[model samples]
Target: MEFHSQQPIHPTIRKCIQHLDVIKADDKTKQIVYMYMESLLRERDLIAASKQEPIESQIHN
Candidate 1:
């Protein structure tokens, strides 16, 4: 997807893209980096979802 001026891309994501471009020949390293990024995204998503829940309900659970 094209990142235009209207859509702000995260700085870390941009850096990862640039890093992957330079290591295209190393599949193992690329896989490790990709997984690390995926885990971070998942953690961020979980945090965001938790914030949307009511504090009372979260405490009850």
Candidate 2:
């Protein structure tokens, strides 16, 4: 699963992710942090997407 493409993240969050390398942690740990941030982005995107206007067409397709 590609995490970065999941959704648009806030600038502050992106900055934090970039700083992950500054932390004294292994690759696996850094990945875990990224995944957590990615999840937050997904949640944010989901909500934003839901707030957008829906299709006017009645067709399910």
Candidate 3:
């Protein structure tokens, strides 16, 4: 279920996750963190997919 080991994230994003005081964050704050992580995963997947495709195909599209 871990997406982190398979994908790389920006240093700032890592720092934010590392520094987050889970015990102190309210429900809303935790939800925001979850959303951010989801977005980051989607962006990483999109970038990886783009790299896998041929440049000619991309140019023609």
Give the Cα error of residue 24 in candidate 2, in Å: 1.9
Q: Give the per-residue lDDT of model 3 (tens digit) for 1-61.
A: 1234565755665556555654566556755785687698789999999899987878854
Q: Which order, best to worst by TM-score?
A: 1, 3, 2
lDDT of 2 by residue, 4-61 (tens): 5655766776676667656756667767877787788789888888677476543375
Best prediction by lDDT = 1
> Which segments of model 3 are wrong by more than 4 Å?
1-22
| Cα lDDT for residue 60, candidate 2 | 72
Between prediction 1 and prediction 3, the one with superior TM-score is 1
Candidate 1 local accuracy as lDDT? 0.69
Q: For every model shown, what is its TM-score relative to the native structure?
A: 0.60, 0.55, 0.55
- lDDT preference between candidates 1 and 2, better one: 1
RMSD to true structure for each model, in Å: 5.1, 5.7, 5.2
Point out the higher-scoring one by lDDT: 2 or 3. 2
